[model samples]
Target chain A: MTASTQMIEEGTALEVDGLVKRFGDLTAVDGVSLTVRAGECLGLLGPNGAGKSTLIRSMVGRVRQDSGRVTVMGKAAGSTEARMALGWVPQELSIYPRITCRENLGSFGRYYGLKGQTLKDAIAWCLHWAALEEKQDDVAKTLSGGMKRRLNMAAGMLHRPKVVLFDEPTVGVDPQSRNRIFEMIEALRDAGTAIVYTTHYMEEAERLCDRIAIIDHGKIIAEGTNEELVEKTFGRRSQVLARFDGETAAIEAWAGRHGGRVKGETAEFTIEQAGEIAPLLDDATKAGLELEDLTLRRPNLESVFLHLTGRELRD
Target chain B: MIALKRDRGALVLSFVLPLAFFSIFAVIFGRQGGGTPTVKLIVVDQDQSQASAALVKGLQSESSLVVMMKPEAKSKSAPAPADYTAATAEAAVKAGDAPVALIIPAGFGQHPIAFGPDAGGSTLELLNDQSDTIAPQIVVGLLQKAAITSMPSAMADEGMKYADKYVGGFTPAQKAKVDEELDALRKAEADGKTGAGSGDSGNGNSGNGSAGAGIVAVNVRAVVGENKKSPMISFYAAAIGVMFLMFTASGSAGALLDEAESGTLERVLSTRVTMTKLLAGKLVFNTGLAFVQLTAMFLWGWSAFKLDFFSHLPGFAVMGLCTAFAVAAFGMLLASACQTRAQLGALSTLVILIMSSVGGSMFPRFLMPESMQKAGLLTINAWAIDGFTKVFWRDLPVTDLWPQVAVLLGVGVVLFLIARRVARRWEFS
Candidate 1:
C-alpha cells in the first residue's frame, strides 16, 4: 500500500482534467479526468462508445477537445512541445504499409524532431526492442499481426518520451503476443515511463494495472488502485459463496434477517458481507440448515467497477 | 521530407511516367514525313568558257540538288561527255559527300555541229544522272536550252562565211529566206522550256530573257520563321503540351483526395502547416513538372520534325504557364468537390479526356468540322493550344494571343478561388 501511494504520486505522468469533446450536439467525451504517473501502468477500461478512444485521441491531438486540458509531463497535450515529450500508439495500426519497419520508425521519430545520429539510434533501438531486428528490412504489410503490433509499440516509443499512450494496442493480437505486450509495458514502466493503456479486456486490466479508471458513456465513473476500489465499493459486505441443503423458506428468513443481497436458488444464496462467516453459519444451524460448502471473496476492482457503473466489465 | 523520400515508388510514378511518354511521343510525332532521305545544294562556278561554264551552270540549276564547286576541286580525271553516265552521278549523290560531279567531256562543244537541225545528225550527247530525280532533270533541261539558244547564233555566223564563199553576190530573197528560217528555229527552241519557269511565264520571260533564262536565282534565301512550321507538327506540339499539363495537374489534385481520405490532410492541418503552404507546394510541383514535360516534348519536335520551336519558345512558355494554371486550378477544384480519391480520378479523367479529345489533343482542331472547331473553342484546352498555334503556326504576334490568355487566366483564377473555398470547407469539416 505504501509502495502504491508512492507510485501514484510519482505515477502522475499525464493528468487529464475536465476533458470534454463534442461533435455538434453529441458529446463524445465528457469531463473525463484521470492520471498516469511515472513507473505506473494505468488501465482505462470501457465498453464500445465509452469515450475511451476519444479520450486517448484528445490526449494525442488526433481529436481536439472542445473543453479540457490534457497535460503530459506537466505541459498541455498536443502542443508540439508537449507532444515532443510523449509517445502515442493509436488504436488503428496507423502505419504506411508500403514502407519498411525501419522507415516507419524513422518517419515517426522525425515527427518528434529527432534526426541524424539520434534518429538512427532511435530506429535501431526500437527495432531491437520490438524484437523485429531480423525483420527490420521487411515491409510493414508483410509482417504478421503480432509483429505489426510490436512494431506499433516500438514506433510509439521511438523518441523515448516520458509518457506513452497505447490505445487498445493489444486488440486483435494473439494471447501470447498480448502477454508479450504486457511484459514490454511492464518493462517500460520499470524504466520509469508512465503508460496510459485503454482496453475492453477486464482480466488484462486486472492483471496489468497499478491503477485503473473505469469509464462509461464519456465519463470516468470510478478510478483508484484495484484493492482500494474493490474494498471501497464492497467494504461493509463481502460475497459468501456457500452451498447449503436447506428449505427455501428458511433461507429467505435468513436473508431477511441478515439484510444482505441474496442471489441464486433457496438451497444456496451467496451473501455479500464481511467479518462474520461464523455468525452466518450459526444462524443457519439454528435454522436447521446443513451448510455443505462455503467460501468468501472480498470484491475486486471488476466487482467495484460493475457495482459503480452498473454494467459488466467484459460487456 | 523523410516520409516523402521513403515513399520512392510514389515519387517515381509521379515524375517518371510523363517523361517517358514525352520522349516516345516526341520521337514519333517529331519525325518529318517519316524521315525520308533528301539533300540540298549550293553551287559556285568561276569558269567563263561557254562550254565549261554551261556544264557547271547546268548542274547548279537543278532542283533539290546539292552542288558545290571550286577551282581546287576540278580534278584531272574528269570524264568526257560521251563517257559520263547516270550511274556515275548517282554514285556521287548517294555518297552525299560531294554535291554533284561535273564532267565537261573533251570536244563537248564540237558535238553540236553534227546534231544541228539542218545537218539531220542524230547523235548529240550531254550526260547527267537522270536517277537523281529532281536535280538531273533541271540540269539536263537547262543544258539543252543553253545549247539551242547559242547554236542559232553560231549557225548564223557560219552561214555568213559559207554564203560568202559560195555565192560571191547574194539576192535579197535568199537572205530573207535564211532570216525567216533562223526566226522559226529561234521560236521553236523558245517554246520547249520546262521547270518552275513554265508556270509564271510573266515572271520567267517578260522582257527579261537574261533574268528568266538564268539557271539559279541569286540572292535567294528561304526564311522559316515563327508560325512557319508545318501545320501538323505545330498543332500536335501545342495539343500534346496542353494535354499532358492537364494530366500532371489532375494527378496532383487526385493526391489531395488521397490525403483527405487517409486523414493526412487533417493531420497536416493540426500541425503548423497552413492550407496556403500546402496548396502552394502542390501547385509549384505541378507547374514545374508540366514545364519539364513541355520542354522534353518540344525538344523532340525540334530534333525530328524541323519544328522551329526556339523561335516560338516565348509564346510556348506563356501558353504553357496559362495552361498549367488552368489545369492546376481545375484539378484542385475537382479534388475539393470530390469526397474520395476514386471519385476525383474518375471525374477529372472523364472531364480532361473529353476536353482533350474535342479540343484537339487526338486531332487538330482545323481538321475538325467548322462547327466542331467552334465548339472546341469553348474548351480551355482548345483556347490554350490555339494560342500557341497563333504564335508558332500562324506566325501571329504574341500580343494577338491576349484574349485567349486572358480568358484562360481568368478561368484559372476563378477556379483557384473556388478550389480554395472547397478545400477550406473540407479541411474543417
Candidate 2:
C-alpha cells in the first residue's frame, strides 16, 4: 500500500513543507509539513486554537507565512494557477445573505475569471452537487442553517478546482447539517477531488479521513491512517475497568487471572477481548470482593489521541 | 450588485438623511424666512431731541429685539423675551441659529459726525450676543443709515461752520441773523434747554461759527449687494451638506464592518477575492451612490429655489467625485482597522464629526479666523464645498475646480494606501 501510494504522485494535489507563521510574539503554526494526495480525504484534528484555522488559511493564500512553502498542483498558493486549482469552504459561512445562492456562486466563479456560459455552467454544477438546485434562486439569508452550509459548499466548488480545503466545516451546526456536510465531502472525495478537512470532532475525523494528523500547540504530534493511530495506543489489547468496594488484595487476584496488572484502586486492566472483562469480574465476586461495575473500552482515534496528548480528544 | 443588495437599508438611509437635511435648510432659509428677525437695541438719547426719537423709532423697526431703553444695564438683570433668552440665542446663532440683539448708546445720534466715515471711533454701539451673526450685521447697516439721517439740524449747522471756515466769508445780513440766533442760543444755554431753542441757537453769536455755514457737502453712492439675502446661505449650505455627507459615509461603511462580523468577508476572501478587488468594488458602488445623492440635493435646491444647477454641473461633478473618492477611501480604511461593526460605528461617528466640524461643515471658514481658514483648506469638506460654491454660486469654469479635485484625490489615494496596508496586515496575521 505504501509503495502504491508513493508510485501514484499524479501531480501532488496540495503540498506544504516547513511552514511557519507568527503573530507578534506568538508562533501559531510552527514548522508544519503536510500533504493531501489526489482523490484522498486528509483530516486535521486538534483542540481549539491549536493552529488548525491558521494552517488552512496559509494553504489557501488567505494568509502568507513567514517561512516555508505551500503549493497546490505544483504551483505556489495565492498564485493565479494555484488559486485556480483549489477550492475553499472556510470555517465561516461567508456568502452575502441578501443575494440569492445563484448570485453568490456567480460572483465567486467570476473571481476565478469564469464568466458567461462557463460561469453559468459552473453554478449549475455546484447547485446539483450540493443538492441545492431548488434553492438556487432563494436568498442565502433566508435559507435554513443546514441549507446555508450546503450552499457554502456549492459556492466553493463553483470554479471546479481539483483540490478543496474545508476548515472546521461542520462546526456550530446541527447534527443533520453536520451529516449532510460529511456526506457532501465524501461524495467529493470519491469523485477524485483531493480534500484537506479540519475538524475538532474526533469521530468525524475517524469516519471521514483516509489519513489523519493530530495537532496540538502549533505542532503535529502524530499523523497516520486511523488503524495505525489505534494500534499505536491499544497494541492488540483492549482496556477494561472494574469497580471495587473491597480490599485491594481481592482485585489483585482477579488481575492475576486476567494476566494483567491492577493499576488503580478502581481495578483497571487491559485485555485482548471483552470476554476477559466478565471472567475477571466473576472471579473478583467469588473471592468475596464487591464487583460494583465493569466496563470495556475499545481502541479508537479518541483513545490514541488521549495516549499521545495525555488529554481527552474533545476538550 | 451583491454588495448593494445586501446593504439596501444602509444605502437608502445614506441618501435619505442627506435629502432630509437639504429640505430642512431650504425651508428655513428660502424666500420665506417665516418672519422678521429680532434685534435688541439699547437706546441712549443724551440729546433727548425729536431727531433722537426718530433714530429710536428706526431702531425699534427691527422685529427681533424687545428694545431696552436704559443706557447700560446688566444683561442678566434685563430679562430677554420669553420664547428664548439672549444666552441661548447667542449659542444657537453661533451654532447657526439666527438670533441677534443690538445696543445703541446715548451718544449714537448725539455725535453722528464724531468720527470720520473711515475711522475706527465710529460710535454706533451694537452689543450683540453673536447668537444670530447675520442679524447683527444687517441691523448695523440699517442703524448706520438711520442714525446719519436722524442727526439734528444743529449738528449739521456745526459741520457747515467748518465748511464756512474753508470758504472764508459771510454777508452782514447773514451775520446779523447769525447774531440773533446766537443770542437765542445764549438764552437757551443759560436755561440749559437746548432742545427747546434749536433754531435760535445758530452759530453766529458765539463767533465760533459762520452764517450759512451748515451747508456740508455729502457724496453718496448706493452700494450694490447690500440688503440682499442672508450672507449666511453659502456657509450654511456647505455646513449642512458636509455634515450630512459625513453621516452618510460613516453609515455606508458600517456595512463593511457588518460583512466582517457576519463572516461574509472571510467567505469572500476564501473564494479568490483579493482585498484590492473588494475595495474597488466597494469604491465604485459608494462613488455612484454619492453622485446620485449630490444630484438629488442640487435638484431639490433648484426646485426649492433658483439654485441654477445646470450652470454649475461641471464644478458639481468635480467636487462630488473628489468628496466621494475621499469618503470611500476613508470608509475602506476604517473597515480594515476596525474589528467589529459596533467599534466601527463608534469610531466613524467620532471621525466624521471631527472632520466635518474642522472642515467648515458647522461654521464658515470665512467667518473663522485667518489661521483657521488656512487650516480649513486641509480638510476635505472645505475644498470640496468651496469647489461646489465656485461652480454653483460663483459661476466659475470647471478648470478652476482642479485644485480642489487634486487635494481630495490626494487624500483619497493616501487613505487607499493605508487601507490596503492595514488589510494586508489583517489577512496575513
Candidate 3:
C-alpha cells in the first residue's frame, strides 16, 4: 500500500487506492486514488470519456480493476458486505419500463433483502422523496423523462446504504427535477451518507460537491475544494475581458506588456487585484485603444478545469 | 450495420441460423415421397395343424406384411410347439418389439369355423400397439384378405360333408347334378368371383341351402391396446402443444437480454442478491409459465377433441413438468449465448422450428424417412412427444415413462449448468 492507500481513516465511507483498469491496449482508468468521508460528497468532474465512469464502476465492482483495492466501510469491494452497504444510480434508465413504478421499486427492494415492514417503509419513503407518489401506479415508460430520473435516483437509495454512487443522475431531466434530486442528495449527505457523483456539468459540481476532483485522460490531475482549486490555478487573479471595435494593434501591444493574451478583437488581462482594473483602463485609453465592451470576471471551477486540462468542462 | 459488424454472434444468428433450419427441414420433407411403408408383423401360431399352416402361408403371401416367426427346430409335418405363447406375443407388441401381432388359437385348423345360425365361429386375435393409426389399419386389411383366401377352402370342405349327409336319399341323377354345381361353385369362389345369382342356377334347394350352412365365417377379433382405437388426434395434440410451449418459453426467457439492455440486470446484481439466485428465479418462473401453457393446451384438447388426457394423468404430468423444465433451460442457454434480444429470438426460433419439424410436431416421425426419424430422436421435442404418446396413445403406465422423464430432466440440468456459467459474465460485468 502507498501513502494514498494509508490515507483511509476510521470514518471514511469509501477508500480507493491505486486503481488501474485497462481494455486491451487502452487504459480506461489509470492508477487513481481518492477517499470520501461520511457525510461528504466528492464531485468527480470531468469531460466525456475522462475515465470518470470507469473509476466509479471500479469502485462499485461492476468492472474489475486490473490492480488496486476499493474498500467500502473497511470491507473489500465486490464483497457481500461491501455491496450491502453500497448504492448506485446509473446514468441510464435502469427501471423496467413495462412494470409500474411501485412494482419496480418492490422488486428492486427485494434484491436488497428488504422485507416485511422495512421494505414497505422504504418504498413509501422513496415514493415521497422522488415525488412519485401520485404516479406510483403508472408504468415507468409512461412517465415523463424527469419523473423517470427521479425514480432512478430513489431506487438506488432505497436500501439506505452507507455510500451512494451517482453517475450523472440528472443527465436529461427537467430543471425542477434536477433541483429536487439535488435536495434529496443533500438530505442524504446531511444524514451521513457518503456520495461519489460524476458529471460533466460544471455548475452541478460547483453547487453540490464539498470537494471536486477534475480528471482527464484517465488520471485525476487536480483534487480540492472549489475555492482552493480556483486560487491554486489562477493565484487570486481575476480576468478583465475587453472587446475592441477594430484592428487594435495598440491594445495587443499594451496587453502583451501587461501579461495578458489577445484573441481576435478581445483582450483578456489577468490582474492581481480588482483595483488594478482602473490603471489598466487608463493605460489602454492612453494607447489610443477603443474598448467596445469591458467586464471583470472572477475565476471559478470552470476556469480551473479549463486551465488544468486546456479544454472546456463540456469538451 | 456497424453494430452487426461488431457483434459476430448476432451476424451469424441473422444469416446462418435460418439457413441451417431450412436445410434440415428440406432434407426431412424431400425424402418423404414414398407412400405407406411396410409394417412388421409378429406371428404366434399355437396350432401346428395343416389348416393353421395354410392361414400362416396366406398371411406371409401378402406383400404389405413382413411376418416375423419364432425360431422352431421341429419337422414341417409334425405339430411343432408354439415358439411364443399368447402372453409373450402381447408383451412383445407392448414393448415395441413389433407393430402388429397375430395369435393363431390351438384349435384354429381342427374345428371348422362355422358360419350360419347353428355353427359357432372361431376368432383370430389381432393385437395392435396402436401407436401408428395407418399401420394398424393396413395390418387389419392384410389379415382380412388372408382370412378371405383361407376361409373358402374350409367352407367347401363343409359343403362336401353336407352333400353326403343331407342329400343321401336323393336320386343318382339329382346327386350327380348337385355335385357338378358344387364343383363349379368352388371354382368360382376360388377365382374371387362373387354374385348371389350364380350359386342359384342348379339344384335350387341343395345349392342355396348348402351355400348358406356350409359357408364357415371367420371372425377377426381386433384387440386394441390402451391408446384406444384412433390415436391421430391425441398424438398431434401432444406434438403441437409441446412445440408451441417451447416457443412461448423461449420468448419469455429472452427477457433477460432486455433486462440487461435496460441496465436493470446490473442494478439487481449490485444488490444483495447473488447471480445464482437471480438465474434460479428466472428458471423457475419460465418453467412454471411453460407448464401452465402446455397444461392449458392439453385441457383444450381434452374438451374440444375428446383426447383421453385424464385417464393417464400421472404420466402426462411428469412429461409436462420435465418438458417445461428442459425447454426453460434451453431458452436461458440461448439467452446467455446471445448478447441481444434479436439474436436470441432468431437463434431460438431456428432451433425450435427445426427440432419440431424433425421431431414430429409439424409432421409425424413415422411418415418421415428412416434417417430423418433417427435424427429426430436427438432433439428434446422428440423425447417429449414420445413421452406424451406413451401416456396418451400407448396408455403406458407412469413407470414406463421414466426414460423420457429422466432424459428431459437430464437435459435441463446440463443446460442450466452451462447457462449459469455463461450468464455470470453478463450479470457481474
Best by DockQ: 3
Q: Between 1 and 3, whose TM-score is larger?
A: 3
After the best TM-score superposition of candidate 3, give how far the Cα of residue B19 lies from its true spot, in angstroms.
6.1
lDDT (CA) per prediction: 0.64, 0.66, 0.78
Write model 3 residue lDDT over A1-315, tens digit each, in one string. Answer: 654345445578898889899989889889899989999999998888889988887777788788988988888888898898899999999998999989889988899998899998999999998889999999999999999998898898778999999999998888998898899889989999999998878889988899999888899899999998888888978878888765568778988888876767888777888888888878888887877999889988887887778677877
Model 3 CA lDDT for position A96: 88
DockQ value of candidate 2: 0.35
Error of 2 at A147 (Å): 0.8
Best by lDDT: 3
CAPRI tier of model 2? acceptable
| C-alpha TM-scores of all predictions | 0.56, 0.68, 0.80
lDDT of 1 by residue, A58-176 (tens): 77666667887887776677666667767877666766678899998887776566889999999998887788999999999899999898987887787787888888888899998
Q: Candidates' DockQ values?
A: 0.08, 0.35, 0.58
User: Which model, 1 or 2, shows the larger DockQ?
Assistant: 2
What are the clash counts of all predictions, listed in order?
12, 12, 0
